[model samples]
Target: MAPGLLDRSRTVAPPGWSRWLIPPAALSVHLSIGQAYAWSVFKPALESSLNLSGTASALPFQLGMVMLGLSAAFGGTLVERNGPRWAMTVSLLCFCSGFLLASLGAAVEQYWLVVFGYGFVGGIGLGIGYISPVSTLIKWFPDRPGMATGIAIMGFGGGALIASPWSAQMLESFGSDSGGVATAFLVHGLVYAVFMSLGVLLVRVPAEGWQPPGGKRPQEQQSRKPLVTTANVSARSAVRTPQFWLLWVVLCMNVTAGIGILEKAAPMIGDFFADTSTPVSAAAAAGFVALLSLANMGGRFLWSSTSDVIGRKNMYRCYLGVGGLMYLGIVLLGDSSKPLFIVCAMVIISFYGGGFATVPAYLKDLFGTYEVGAIHGRLLTAWSTAGVLGPLIVNWIADSQEAAGRSGAGLYGLALSIMIGLLAVGFVANELIRPVNPKHHLPEPASAAGQAEGTAGHEGGAEHKEATGR
Candidate 1:
C-alpha cells in the first residue's frame, strides 16, 4: 500500500458542517429567489403602465425563465468546481441587483430595461441558486436523495406563497398610484439582499473525517472508487445518448403542460363557466391560484419521496400517464364542475413539482453524481424551450378566441388538446429511457461494490464505512 497516499486523503473533507443545517441556509436563498414566481402579481401594473397586452406583459417572465435555464446550463460545471457557498453568494448579488435595476427601469418608464434587469440578470440568479445546493445535499444524504431534494425544492414552490402576500403589502405601503410598482421593486431588492447574505455567512463545507452520524464507514478505510468518479459523460455526449434527449423531452413536456394552466389560471377558470347561471368571482379565481400553489409545493416533497420507493422510472410514468389522463378529463368534461377542474389541476401541479424534484435524482441515477450538475444544467435548456412554448400556447389560444368573440370552455379546448399531445410526447420520451452505458460507470473500490447488486437485503449488506458526523 502507498503510505503517503493514505495521509493525503485524510486532509480533505466532504460537503458540509452538518446536513440538517444546510437546508435552512438553502431555504433562505430559495425562498428569496422565489419572488420570480410572484412576477404575476405585477402583471396588472405592467399592463396599465406600459400599455401592453397580456401576451406582451408576460414576455419578461418568459425571458427570465429562458435565462434561468440557459444560465444553469452554462454554469453547472462551474458551480461544481467551486462550492455551494460561493455559487449562492453570487446568486444573491445578481438577484438583488436585478431588483434594484428593475426599480430604476420602472421609475424611468423603460420596459426593455426592466426586462433586461429582471429577465437576464435575475434569471441567472435563479439558475445558479437553484443548482448550488443540489449536489451538496445529495452528497450529504445519498441514501435519501429524493427526500433531500424535496425539502429544498419545496422552498422554491413556497416562495410565491410568501412573496405574493408580502409584495402586495409592500406595493400598498410604498407605492403611489403613479409609481407604486417601482417603489415595491426597490424594497424587494434591499430586503432580499440582507436576508440572503445570512445564508452565505452560515454555509460551510464539512470538516475532514465528517460523515453522517452513523455512516457506513470511514470512507478512506474502504476500497472505494477513485476520489474522482469516471462514469460521467460530457454534456455534449449526454445529449447524444437516447436518455438525455428523452429526459429532456420528458421535462419539457411536463413543465409545458403545467405552466400552461398556471399562466391562465384565473382567466381559464372564469372562462370555463361563463355560460353557467353562476359565474366565478375574482376572489374564487384567486383561491384557485392559491390551491395550485399548495399542490405545487406539497407535490415537491410527496411525489419526489415516492420516487425513492418506486424508482424514478415508475414515478415519471405516474406523471406522464396519469397526468395525461387528468388533462383529458378537463378537456372531455369541460370546466363545468369546480370539483373536476380543481382535482385535475391539483394532480397536474403535483406532478409538475415532482418532475422538478425528481430530475436531479434522476440525473444522479443516469449520469452519476460526478457530473450530474453539468448534466442537469444542460437539461435545463429544455426547460428554457418549454418556458417559451407553454405560455405561447395558452395566451395565443385565449387571445385568438377572445378576438373571435368566444368565451367559456370553448376558448380552452384547443389549448387542452395541445397539452394532451405534449403529454403523449412525454410518455414516449419516458419509455425511451435506458440506463447510461457501463463505459461511463466509474470504477469503484472493491468495498463500494462489495456485495453485488440484489445481494444487499432491505438492510444494506455492508454499511458504508464512512467516518463520524461532521
Candidate 2:
C-alpha cells in the first residue's frame, strides 16, 4: 500500500547478485509468520485465564488454520501478479495487526474478538506469506528449486521451535494470567512486524534476461531429463489437470498422517503405556514432543534437498510409501517397545515435514515455475483439510474405542489402520502422477518469454534495489 510499493523496476535482481541471499530473505518472512504453530503454547494459558474448555480454547487456532487454507487458495493468483514484495508487505501488516487485535481481545476478555483478530486476519497473512517466497526462490535457484524452497519452508517448521520456548519464557517472566498473555501477543506482533520487514526489503525478482551462473535454458539442456514438464501451465489450467487433484490428495494424506501424531504427541505416548509395564513419565512425554519438533524441522531441509538428487516424484514415494510402513511398524510395535515407538514416530514426522518442504518443488516440476507460487498456494487447502482430518481421525477413534472399553494400544489400533489406508491412497495418487498432457502446455513463444522474464514484476519500473541494499 505504500507509494511505489509494487514498482516493477525495483524487483528485478541486478546481474551478478548472489542467489544465496534469497534464502535468508525468504526465511525472514517464513520464520516470523510460522509462529502460528506456537499457538499451542498459549492454549493452556487461554483456557485457564478465560475459563474456557480445551476445545473452546482451540477455536482461534483451528479457525486460523481454516482461514489460512481458504485465503491462500483464493489469493494465489493475486500473489503471482503482485510480486513477492507486495505479498510480503501485506503479510507483514496483516500478521502483525492480527496479534495486536488479538492482544486487545485478550485484554478485554472478548473471545470472539480474539477469534476474529488472530484467526480471520492473521490467517490471511499466513497464506500470502507462505507462497510469497516460492516462485521467487524457484526462479533464483532454477537448478536447485527443492533446496531453495526447503530452506524457506524449513524456517516455518523451525519458527515454532523458536517461538515455543520464547513464549514460554515470556509467560514465565511476566505472569501466566490473561494480562500476561495479552502482553505476549502485543510483543509478538511488534517483534514479528520488525522481523518480517527484512524479507519485504530484501527479496528480489530476477531481471528479464537474468539466469543463474552457467545455467542453461530448457532447450539447451535437452540432453538432461527434467522431473516435470518444462512447458508452462497457467494456474487455472493447472487446477483443471488431474495432476493437480492427485497431488492434492497426496499432500492431504501426508499432512493428515503427520498431524495425527503431532496433535496428540504429548498425551499419546503416555496413554500408550499407561496400563503397560513401561509406565511412561511426564518428562518422557515432553521429550517425545521435543523430538517430534526437531524431526519436523530437520526433515524439511534434509528430505527436501534430497529430492533434487532423487527427483521430486521419487522423494514423495519415500515420504508416502516408506512413511506408511513406519506407521504400520508403530501400530504393531510402538506399544510394546518405547525405543521402537520413538524411532518410528521420529521417522514418520520427518516424512511429514518432508512432505511440506517438497511440495513446492513438486509443483514446479509438474506445472513449471511461471505460476508455481500460485499453484502451491491453491494446493495448501489440502493442508487445511488435513489439519481438520488428521486430528479428527485420531481423536474420534481414540475416544470411541476408549468408550468401548479398549485400553492402551487397542484404542489406537483402528486409527493407525486408517492412517495406513490413507497412505495407501496417497501412494496410488503419487503413482498416478504422470507428465502433464501437452494440451495443458502454453504455446512456445509466450511460454519462453514468460520463463525468461524469470519472475513477474509490477507495471511501473521504478528502482527497488535500495530496499535490498543494492
The TM-score leader among the candidates is: 2
Error of 2 at 174 (Å): 2.7
TM values, all candidates:
0.83, 0.93
The Cα local distance difference test for each model comes to 0.75, 0.85
The lDDT leader among the candidates is 2
> Residue 201, candidate 1: how far off, in angstroms?
2.5
Query: lDDT tens digits, residues 1-470, model 1?
Result: 66332131221244434568777877888888888888887887778886778877777777788878888898986776555676787799888888888888888988887888888898889999888778666656666667777888888898889999898887668653427878888889999999887667655544423455665532223344222122444454566688888999999999999999988988888889777887889999989988999999999999988886677878899999999899999988856687898899899999999999888888766765544666788888887788779989999998998789877898888888899899899988888887777654433532232212112210111232222110
TM-score, candidate 2, is 0.93
Could you give candidate 2's per-residue lDDT for residues 1-470 as a string of tens digits? 65495664567777877778889999999998888898988989999998989988888887888878887898987787778888999899988999999999999999888888999899899889899989999888777778889999999998888998999999887787889989999999999999998898888888876766765443214445555677878787899999999999999999999999998888889988898877889998999999999999899999999987788889999999999999999888888888899999999999999999999999988888767888998999899889889999999999999999998788888998899999999999999998889898766654665575444422211122223232
**How large an RMSD does model 1 have?**
8.0
lDDT of 2: 0.85
